[model samples]
Target: MRKSPAAKAWTRCAVSGIAAAVALSASLSGCGLPAADPGNPGRPVAAAAAAGSQGAAGNPAAVTAGSRVLNPANGRLEAVVPEVSRTVLLIGDSQSEPVDGWPRLGLAAAGYNVYFCGRGGTGFVSSNGATGNYIDALLRGDWLLPSGTPALIVIQGGGNDAAGAASDRQITANAERLIAELRERYPSTPMAMIGTLARGEAHGGGRRTEVDALLGSVAASHALPFVSVGDWLTRYGLAKDLADTVHMNPAGRQKLGVLLEGRLRDLGLDRKPTADQQPLRASGTRDDGPGQD
Candidate 1:
């Protein structure tokens, strides 16, 4: 008897110790959120092509305080400074949980103060009995930070939904509801969505393909930057970087951080470190709290 692809993926996830990752997510502590870098107070850091552009090297240029640049990724023209005046919010599932997950690390590396709200095994449409689903959490104010409004918001999920065989209509409806709620709350805040993960060559043909497509369509309708990182592991030659079928290891996490930095830069959403900004800790631990559900 042959194992189904879904079973194979699930087996890989279990073998990779995803359970441990969830435990780690729960034990993590929030860092002492730092202020902007104090060295260049009040001055806007100028964006240099080398520092702001995403090329084949996959390396993100160091952003200075108060720089303005055109992001080649999403063709959005915007300033990178003033980010110091706000925070960034990330909402996602297990893949984006764990203090050291790529999305959180990447946003922090790019000079933004980040607040992450991740629930392992949860998705835009899937509910974690404790905190409910992403939309429910937001609606109930369970994920709000104890500070100012976020300058940007990023939503990452779909893997769990796809794995569970959630219907296309279900995913889309839930996604639209999530986006609508977010827009109603923060009408002007910039938002982006990331799709499911998969092997490089198998991306467009993988199990989560439909979920990814629906996510892209939703993003398109909202005119938001929608990043499909399914092939990132294979595209960047980080196959060995995966800790499981869907999660990234430390090395993989670092690589993903760089990739996300480049993507944010491309979307003109990269943050410029303020003079008061503090440096990222070597341990890469700056989460606000444990996974809620």
Candidate 2:
């Protein structure tokens, strides 16, 4: 039987800042959650990069977080650590869940490494029967990120909320609270949002699109950069690419990943220029290259 709000996970790892290159150890604890919707297996802290990036491969799947040593110095559960500008913390659901999916593929292509806090059947307000909602889980230590600050934080999902029975008000409240919490934790880090994937009503799109728009509003309220893909399937004519009504096939995932890569680039979410360094391209194959699982 299928259960709503099933997957919950977070990956932890730390790399020194480029300018400083000072190595700092961070302790992270998160149990892997299988992506329940499609029954995808869980992935630990994985690393992907272009040829010249960290891993030194054309398309290396990822180097799990196991490769790193954790420091129990202060013993804070989710202690504060230094910022690594090349890493991104991603929270998502089925449309592009995690470990392997369009969002991961796209972000990899954009030259950013990922530390995913992904879960299927989970969303802002839609609590997974197994893991609770996003905000509560983070607060209660259900999911703990690496001690260090990531370059950017991205919240990606709304399918669960759209499918869930939670009211719009509840969703907004939870989303707002999560954002505020993250802001407090990583005040200097940039944040972005990837809205719910939808086909639009003409193609049987329902509350998914509505929730996408609602999330967009929420992101805007906080001045968070947002990407709206509510009408992507219909707009991009990817109907044939869908494995079913909602999920996409491998080809679709690649296409969507490419689309997302460009979108993130345009939005300056992937590699926004810092005060010290000029914005430069992250290494990765522009076409037909992804460090996917």
Candidate 3:
């Protein structure tokens, strides 16, 4: 197990909400709000007031539970793993498509099975051209989850909304709608948000960072524990860590996973589920320790 002395130190940070996120960003080598490129300046994003895969693998062509599968969407493959109890439901986009991706590895390190629900190019209201948005997918039964209530319901996405034509208000409205539905379905379950992984202006960061802050505002409004990673690329000096214009390479993914684990500790969202949410463990899965089988 990778003991988290770093995570333990991070839990002491007073980054209670995204408001503190600005300070955190500013503190990191001047990694403050991204430079204006998408026609919007810094900090005004938060002033807008909130609006709104795969894993484990070592395979490409194979389609196992922890491998890539054809996305229910129109374009390429997405990561997937079967649902299990004592899990965290991650609903997000292509950024979360790697079965061995950032948040999945981070959350697994935090001690929980993960079940992903969204695919590439999708967000709260934005679609991947074929599959519906997060809310629409849930309503249309495009993404099915396990029967039992999971430990936590984490809503993560914003890149698609930011990149696509959806306005901030539309993103907020759809996000709220999705949250309302999730609250109805899992009343006792706690929820959280992870903002978009982004870069600075020099790295083509603009609307994506803006959407990250906007989602932070939304999470703040809902009083959800939000991890604002909007400035992460520039902050962590990850310019070379990208696999593409929008996604991260394996090295970048690993580094961000560690960073995310620390943030989860900071927000006190790293604990495992309670007795009620801890149903019988699924077969072939072992609860040896945090991040371990």
Model 2 has an lDDT value of 0.60
RMSD of each: 14.3, 13.8, 16.8
Leading candidate by lDDT: 3
lDDT of 3 by residue, 250-276 (tens): 666666766787788788887566766
In angstroms, give how far residue 1 of model 1 lies from its true place.
52
Off by over 4 Å in 2: 1-83, 272-293
TM-score of each: 0.64, 0.68, 0.65
- Give the alpha carbon lDDT tens digit for every residue of 36-149 in model 2: 211122432221111113442343333233322122442223312223466677766655452336776666556565555645667887765566678877776565455556
For candidate 1, the 10 contiguous residues with the lowest summed lDDT are 26-35
Residue 26, candidate 2: alpha-carbon lDDT: 27
Candidate 3 residue spans exceeding 4 A from truth: 1-85, 200-204, 273-293
Query: In candidate 3, where is summed lDDT lowest over 10 consecutive residues?
Result: 284-293
Q: Please, what are the lDDT tens digits per residue for candidate 1 over residues 1-293? A: 99996456445434333323432332221121123322444433222422443321364344433333444443322233323255676778776776667776666556566556657777877776565677776655444222224678888888778777778888889899999977766667789998876664464436566677789898999898988876776676777776766777766765677677667778787765558865332112332233221
**Candidate no. 3 TM-score:** 0.65
Cα lDDT, model 2, residue 199? 89
